[model samples]
Target: MGGIDREKVKGSFHRQAKTYDQYARVQKRVVANLLDQVRKEVGTPGRILDVGCGTGKLLAELHRLHPEAQLFGADLALGMCITAGAHLAAGAFVTADAESLPFIDGAFNLVTSTSTYQWLPALDHAFAEARRVLAPGGIFLFALFGERTLFELKDAHYQALKREGEVEDITHRFFPPSRVEAALAGAGFDQWRVESTLEVELHADVPALLKSLKKIGAGNASPRASAGLYGRKRMLAMMDIYQEKYGTTDGIPATYEVIYGAGRCP
Candidate 1:
């Protein structure tokens, strides 16, 4: 897997910190579904740690559910951590990387993340770190984008560029459910379950879809992604291509293939 540019990712998310919550509908939904699953499978955790807890939405939710439990959040972006801390005046927030958590072994009973792992180049390191921090028999629950995520947008970009004998790769190749399961197992997790889901959001046009991504600071952080901002010509062409191919009676649909995984450290 190609390594992600950490500074680039931090900058993007930091820039969107103030406005992220407005356009993070899909992310919020992922957190909600993940929490619901946690509730169904096990009770509220005694101590909770949310990796890549952007904007602290999930932390706020967890706080609401288990007011007495200890809660914490960490993210690579300082601005995101600051914003999260300010929003949720209770939880302890820190700037940390998932591959190398700034905590002692078995520091948390439950570790979770949503829409964050795809940005990581090595799932093994991250999973291992999660396992290290989790107590014995503790649950690790997470949701990540799978390979099929943003296919429509990706396809549109390729097709638009191909018209001029060029190729545009603007997104990361997200890990599949099978790969994620293998990574979790390799990290010493047991009885893990991985499931795939398609979450679709409708936009009136391609620009709106792009705006949604920008608002959530989700512009690709892949090393392969273009460093420069998109040009007007290419942007317009992609919009046309997407509308021509995947447009429905309602609107253009941006599909997110969400991979949900949960298991226990043994």
Candidate 2:
């Protein structure tokens, strides 16, 4: 459980490929924001690479905005690639890994990823690979969850387990903003600027929130797996604790802390 297994992670997304678009609200928002940032800084580009291009939604938007650009979409999941090929603009889809892009170096002027970097087993290598694939002065726009995401739930779950004299491991993993920024810098990206904004959404209950995450093929893709089954009693107790702690003015509670970052490749 040192790091994520890329094949297993890819398979999870592949299984959810057909239904990913239906439940990817956070992803959609993040990608739109990333695209907007790109437009503001880099304007229209002649070539673009959509890394971890889930269903090619971002690629489609880019193609519409910059139709002249050669847009390429890459995802580790073949199913995602196929789905993207069918949904995205013609000639803009490929199956590839983020850490090892197949295209030549400096081929793309803009590289964008939406809601998919956290699952990478090695962020430094991935960032370096992304920098290598980008042309000089190219832009890299991405969105990932920060360490604060699901804090209440994670804390409550672990606290409950610890209180019961048991240890539990969760599948989700998130890095701090500073750590992410350092990785980007270490990857040789210059003019780097990173910012994180909190995005909270209300959920009727934990099950609903968990279901949405699963539908998007985004949950605990890390190599670490949860031990001890969360039975009905434990789940209910956990929910009670979460509600007591995080319930808002409204009846429903909120989950998720989304972090967005964008930088330029030197």
Candidate 3:
């Protein structure tokens, strides 16, 4: 695969603007954890920039914590920007890409994101942008899905395809902690630390899980992904495989490997 189709990804989030927060349970948890970590590692930020600030959720929390600080949000999707701007009267929202921010060097004292970077195929440019936009001693706090995230779903789909005499790998790949560390080092971000945590969400079944992902604008936007993933036969096969392999009496579990990291500008 060349890389994630950014336009498609933008469209995905744009289409889900109305329902994003309703279905973003995992995202809410991740950002809450991100905020807690931010409070622990950094002092009062003068100017904060939130990358991929979908619907201003993180910005809202930051505003709640630091009412005196300035807030700004950036998202590639115009719909998301508009949605975020609607409720956040205190912050400025802009349509911009994470790989190439429109801000000046050292424009922000704190940069934050959550449940965003996993969509990018590579991290060099995005990480560099985060580092570039941070002032000296500023901190970058972020949480992204790690490689182990959604393993059961990937495994089930692979087995479903294999049983049907097909061979393909269409699921989107998430970066591991090592790659994240490497990207931060490459970006010249100093005093960095990264950790992985497992967070599991229980869904009614495969279809429900798929719907949750779609509603949250987390659909697989990989160029190599095909319609076969949702085919009736393949989907049903996947459901059975998933239930038999990873299900519990409570419900079917969807595992998310959340990788949280923080770095300071030297």
Scored by TM-score, the top model is 3
Highest-scoring model, lDDT:
3
Predictions in order: lDDT: 0.87, 0.78, 0.90
Question: TM-scores of all models?
Answer: 0.95, 0.91, 0.97
lDDT of 2 at 244: 79
Residue-level lDDT for 83 in candidate 3:
94
- Screening candidate 1 with a backbone cut-off below 3 angstroms (N, C-alpha, C), the clashing residue pairs are none
Query: TM-score for model 1?
Result: 0.95
User: Who is ahead in TM-score, 1 or 2?
Assistant: 1
Alpha-carbon runs more than 4 Å astray in model 1: 1-3, 167-170, 227-230
- Write model 3 residue lDDT over 1-266, tens digit each, in one string: 23687877899999999899998888899988998897888789999999999999999999999999999999988999999999899999999999999999999999999888888879899999999999999999999999888899999988998998888676778998999989988889879889999999999887889899889888787886665476787889989999999888888988899999888999
Q: Which regions of candidate 3 deviate over 4 angstroms? A: 228-230
Q: 104-160 in candidate 1: lDDT tens per residue? A: 999888898998999888799999999999998898999999989989998988887
